[model samples]
Each structure stands twice: as structure tokens, then as C-alpha cells.
Target: MSYIIMEIKKISSVETYPVRHEVLRKGKPIETCIFKGDDDEQTIHLGLFLDDQLVGIISVFKEQNNLFSETNQFQIRGMAVLEEFQGKGLGTKLVKEAEKHCINLNANVIWFNARENAVPFYEKLDYKIIGDSFLIPEVGIHFVMYKKIH
Candidate 1:
């Protein structure tokens, strides 16, 4: 593959809506893209800009899961990359950036409820599944996946 310039930086939560809506929420209402802790002070949104276009986005919140014993945990949510950017490794890059930020905040683990179709993607990044898949109402089946980051 030829060289390409990729820019991933901290972005506002609102800036993540479009990408998440397009890639994750599709026919669902726009309000579905607005996560509960999106506007929290400790939440961080990362955007992957390819030639100035926001092709990938990820949001991380400082939330703990009872499944994990770690006191400092971060949950990654609303991670998406445009269809055109798929298979280009952009998703992996976005996740790595999130992990870096979580580490800086002394986060001991990074976890999220991965959509069934996305399980392979997170598994490739070394995340492990903790329990049986569960339904997320309108969102379909999901698995709780996590990776120790400290």
C-alpha cells in the first residue's frame, strides 16, 4: 500500500454524531446516536480525518463495568468508520488512539459492548469476551469485550 496521511485527534461529542448515525444507527432515530455520557467532562471523542474528511470516529467514557474488578475502567462507545474506509485499518487506528488516552488517565481496562458483527474486529485487537451475548433492545445482540490497558 502507498503512504497515506491519517489524522486522529480529540473532537467534540457532537462532531461524532454524523459518522455514528451513518455507520451505526442507520434507520434508527438521530437521537440514538447521542450516548448518555457523551457530554461528560471526562469523555473523549476521537476523529480520524483522512484528507480533512472525518471518516472514522470513536468515543470513550470513564465508566466502570461490574464484570471487571478494575477500579479505573473506560468504556469505548460509538466507534465507526465509513463503509468506504473499511478494510483500510482505520478502525484499528482509532481504537489504538483511544487506548492511549485511557492509559494517560490511569485507566486499568478498556471495555465495551461490541455488536455481534464487530466481535471479530475487536478480537483481532486482542480484546476478550467475558460473557454470553445479550440484546440491547433496538441495537440487536452484543458481547461485552475488554482489554487490559494499564
Candidate 2:
């Protein structure tokens, strides 16, 4: 098997939609991948590339969550890795890179509404589920997961 080098870098929010739609939204409309804070000035989107092709994506927004009293908290959203690249440590790399990015901005915490299936992945990265699972309308079950970055 040939080894492929992966490049992880900061990208524009619009650049994240294709992978997000393909892997996260699936049968849903493409517009479904365009999240609320995608264009926020304080939001940062990270894309993982393999040989110049984008394969994974995640977005971090400088936002406060009521559950966490910290004012320097950020929320992770629109995190998706293409099906073929799902278990190759690409997602872990993306989150780690995002944490570094958050630290540069002086962020103390990073949180997200993680899908049920992804809880284990986040747990491996030391993110804790803050509350019981809840349904997100058409999005199935989810948990509020968070980690301290500072």
C-alpha cells in the first residue's frame, strides 16, 4: 500500500461544504451543510487534504455556550471526514490542529453537539459529554461534548 501524506490547513468556510455535505448530510440537500456560523469573522475552518484533494473538514467558532461559564469558549461545528478517510487518524489530526488554532486565539474551551456515533471518537480525544443525549430534530441523537484547550 502506498503512503499518502495529508496536509491540514486553515480554509475558507465555503470550501468545507462539499465534504460536509457528502459525509455529514448525505441524502440531505447540499445547502444543509452551510451552517449558521460559517461566515462569522471569528470562525475558523480547517480542511484536511490528501495530495491536493480535500478529504476532511472541521470548523471552529468563537462563541459562548451557556453550559460553560467561560467567556473564552469556542464551539466546533461541521466536522466531517470523507468515508474513505474515516479511520485513518485524519479526524484526530484535524481536532488537534483546531485546538492549536484555538490556543493561539486564547480560547479556553472547545465544545460541540456531537452525534451519538461520534461520541467514542471525541472521547478518545479527551472530550467529555456534558449531558444526556438529545434528539436534534431530523439529525438524530446527539450529546454536548467539550474539551479544555488552554
Candidate 3:
């Protein structure tokens, strides 16, 4: 068996767009990967690198959802791992790193609109669905999922 060297680090929002577009918005306009608040001062983007090559990414924004009244909540968005590098616990490592960052910011909760197929993945990470699944125009179905990370 071969070993892979991985490193997780805080990255700029722009650094996340490439993997986000490739994995989450394939065949769609590159602009689709540019999320709102990506440039916010309080937002953070995390990238997972394997052998010095970026292969996974996730972003966290200081935002609150109306569904939850938590004063210090961070929204997780644009989480994606490259097709070849997926299913190897890289996504979990990215999330664990995000949680550490969130805790440092005093955030009590983290939430996101998770794609339907990704529900089980989030569930495995202890995130729970908040309500019924809904459709995102041109994106397909999703559910609001959250976890108390504090």
C-alpha cells in the first residue's frame, strides 16, 4: 500500500472556487461557484492538500439561519473533495478543522444546505436535518442540516 501526505490549512475564498466548481458545479458556469459572502472579513476557507496538491475544500461564514436562533452560528458552504481523492476521510478532516476554527471564533453552531446525496455523509458526521428537503433552482434537492460544534 502507498501512503499519502495530507495537510489541512486555512485558505482564501478564491482558492476554494476551483474544487467547488469541479466537484459541485460540474458543467455549470464557473461563476456558479462564487458564493455570496465569500469575501467577507469573518468568513474562512479551508483547503485539504495531498502531497502538496490541493484536492479538497470547505468554507465557513459567520451567518445565522432564521430556523435557528443561535447568536454565534457559522454556515458551512462549498464543501467538496476531488473525485479521485474522495471517500478517504479527507472531507471529515476538513470538517474537523473547520470545527476547530469555529470554536476559536466562539461559534456555537454550524449549518448548511446539504445536497440530497450528501445527507448521509453529513449524518455520519453527526449533523441532523432541520426540516423537509427542498429544491434549489438549477441545483436539485437539498436539506438544511446543522450541528452544535461548541
Write down the lDDT that model 2 would get. 0.91
- Tens-digit lDDT track for model 2 on 11-119? 9988998998898888998889888978989998999999889999999988899999888999999899999888989999999998888888888889999999999
Can you rank all candidates by lDDT, best first? 1, 3, 2
Error of 3 at 40 (Å): 0.5
Candidate 1, RMSD to the unseen true structure: 1.7
lDDT of 1: 0.94
| 45-138: candidate 1 lDDT, tens digit per residue | 9999987899999999999899999999999999999999998999999999999898888889999999999999999999999999999998
Pairs that collide in candidate 1 are: none
Tens digits of lDDT, candidate 3, 1-150:
989888998899878888998999999999999999999999989999988899999999999899988899999999999999889889999988988888998888999999999999999999999989999998999999999865
**Top candidate (lDDT):** 1
Candidate 3 pairs with clashing backbones: none
- lDDT, residue 83, model 1: 96
lDDT of 2 at 33: 86
- Compare candidates 1 and 2 on TM-score and give the better one: 1
TM-score of each: 0.95, 0.95, 0.95
lDDT of each: 0.94, 0.91, 0.92
Which model is ahead, 1 or 3, in terms of lDDT? 1
